[model samples]
Target: MRSLIKIYRATADRVTGRNLDKAAARKQLRILEEIEFVCIGAVAFGLFLEMPSLCSAASLVAFGVLGEFVIHRFHVRASKREQNLSDKESNEQLAAIAEVNLKAETERLKRVEIEERRAPRRLSMEQFNIIESRLRAFAPVEIGVIPTAKGDAEPLEFAADLCVLFRKIGWLPAFATRIDHTIRLGLWVELSPNADRLAQRAAPELVVALRIAGIAVDQDVSRPAGGEFGGTGEEKERACGAGIILNVGLHPVTARGY
Candidate 1:
């Protein structure tokens, strides 16, 4: 019953020159379709009256073919309208998705900028535990913590964190002392030429522990020039346990090809 009703309505629309699927087609295009229907009907009527001899047969056939042509044209134009509408909708959806992705990336960059403003140089308790276990045999070894002079506060804060990590593991790490040095970047563990076997073994372990804790420290190439850890005049820093000194230089570089 519903199909019959739809068929009846479609026929009625063609006879009355009504617009087809107004919501799916543009207003001007629908008006043009309606005008075509009216013109076809008028032309068919005029041909029927002018040819009285074959008006009932040949003229009727001509009108039927012209009616089919009009319906075919309407369907072709409606299909084009629907395809254009779908393409427009698809483009809008893609543009919206691109905007959302760009905004998320901008927010991520802002977060990175804020994180770079301050150094996240401290270790968590879990990191401390990992370092402590790695440096277990090196306990009771005294370590001298030294910060480079004319450096920013980040290195000092990093040195303080290092001292805390050592103290929690039963080691006597010295108070942080600042002095000028030729070294300008990164953390280092001192290993002078005169150091004994115990200091030699323990220094590398400390470096490994710090590296495991996500902190980069150098033990290799850390022996001072001329085998002496000296700097500006009258600067005498403490030394502990076979000359093991923790030198905190400038903050670890982020992008030196490291």
Candidate 2:
């Protein structure tokens, strides 16, 4: 009996391998054990009823096959149930993360409002009019300003000024501040993969414009993680969708430029 148990365990290990789903495999093994017992009982009962050896063997085989079919159906259903439960849990986690992000956004907005009230207006109406006049030749585009840290008002202020300038030139501009620790230096203008040709062409010009406005700006093109251009220690930023992602970094006095 011990030798048989050892053989069974060896066979199970060989069949399942190292990467097999243990829970599902164990459930299937249990079902197989139950089927083995049922087959044995059916064979014994058939023999006790004076059935021929051939008839008993056929009955055992039929019972085993039927048991396997039923157990297989149950196994499939069980796997699907587990998968659904996993998906539900994952979705709930995602929703929770989104809620947290929303709350953080709300807080950032409040800070921005406070900052706007406290920080004296830097650009006069006449200077803004001149920027608007210069931007008249270029078509309008939506711009997003993302700050790298909370309460870092320099980037937010720069974005705000750009927003005012762009709005004056009939462009849509929005800003969102986030607490990202990766960004260290000059402001980054990230363009989306499917960004319009006009936007792509205007991106460099916008960078130049920001520099001329005394704000240090650079184009940020992040490579895919684990790719040839990606560094081992670098955290890849998520891609912006169909527009521009402006990453606001720290002021020069706070951190050195990269």
Candidate 3:
């Protein structure tokens, strides 16, 4: 009988696509065992009480088959439920990741828009040519333009004008924007430590010339701000070597300093 039971279990395991050691298979087997025991007890009682022997045997067989079917159905339902839950969890995780990526992309695009808005305006060809000619006469100074935050379009326009003017003069000028509390209006010259003696001497005359050209000028030459050129503060200072920084602000051009 034990050998027959083992054979039955092995066959059932293969048919049901489950291992007898697994939880689902073990649960089904336990329930089936209980049903078989109850059925056998009923048959034995019927025989001892002189009831119909055939009917008792038939009842035992029917109960055994029914129990097996019920347990199999239960296992199938449980497996399906577990699968659905797993799928739901996977979907939720994917949705969360996608949402985070979308938010990051949106923020990146927003930053790009702000930068585009802050970009400097272009200078016309005629204005470019004139400024270029004027800047060419002051070549070898390696000037840079730094616009103030509050200067609005005026500073940007001045920087653009300087770029074209300096480019025409055969000098590629560095251009950048910075925030300064003390600066309100006017164009100031910042001299680097390596600046030649001639540039230092010409600085005062350059300021006078700028003032005469309908531009407000800073009276004294100053040092470049920490990060006035580009990159980090130290990098900007290093880049400003032996060069002049032209700071453009919002104030209207006047006969004298603002």
Candidate 4:
């Protein structure tokens, strides 16, 4: 039994980088152990009444406790190993995604490289003035900022609700999907005075929901200045673009913080 506990500790230490959240894990293990002891006691009480061998009943209880301890130790070790593997896989996936993103950026830069090279020296005065006029005519509009980690599910809910809101209210159909850990929502939503308000309110709700669901909410909120648009609309009424989210965890509710 001592050797088994040593093995369990070693396994956990190796897998969790020696930074295991001991408080949380120990709390959970203790709960399980308590439940096991209660069950074993009940069973022994019934057996002892039938057989009248107090010594044997006591030994049986000891065995039950030892068995439970072993199981508890193994369970903790297994969970840590699984978590370690999951973390490793997640890092690998992120690296692959970053590589792909870099390649795409390189391709885009190459396509615009020639145009950028020829841009400055050959431009006539009249052409430059026209470009400047166009730039000035483009109004800079502010969209609400979405803070990453404000809520656990903000990113997903905001994206889903945005897609729906954009399609129905703005009359622009948009697609929403998760790419890696990021949720990407792209489509044209008709610009209106209340668009910012709707986005701001919805974004925070999603973050809260994700936190409740036990999934870490951390991401950047980004919107491009210009995209494809179909028509204009009046700000007749305000609406919400809120998404749904929830929390999930293997740890007991009370032990989650640990």
TM-score of each: 0.59, 0.36, 0.34, 0.32
Model 2, 90-157: lDDT tens per residue? 55555556666767888999999998766643545655665566555665665555556566555556
Instruction: At residue 183, give the lDDT of candidate 3.
Output: 32
Backbone clashes under 3 angstroms, per model: 0, 0, 1, 15
Error of 3 at 88 (Å): 96
For model 2, the local distance difference test gives 0.52
Q: Cα lDDT for residue 175, model 4?
A: 31
Which one wins by TM-score: 2 or 4? 2
* Residue-level error in angstroms, candidate 4, position 130: 15
Q: Is candidate 1 or candidate 4 better by lDDT?
A: 1
TM-score, structure 2 vs. true:
0.36
Show the colliding residue pairs in model 1: none
**What is the Cα-based TM-score of model 3?**
0.34
Per-prediction RMSD in angstroms? 13.9, 22.1, 18.0, 27.4
lDDT of 4 by residue, 114-203 (tens): 766444222234433443343222222222222123343534444444333323322222332222232312211322223343333333
Better of 1 and 4 by TM-score: 1
Report the poorest 10 consecutive residues by lDDT, candidate 4.
242-251
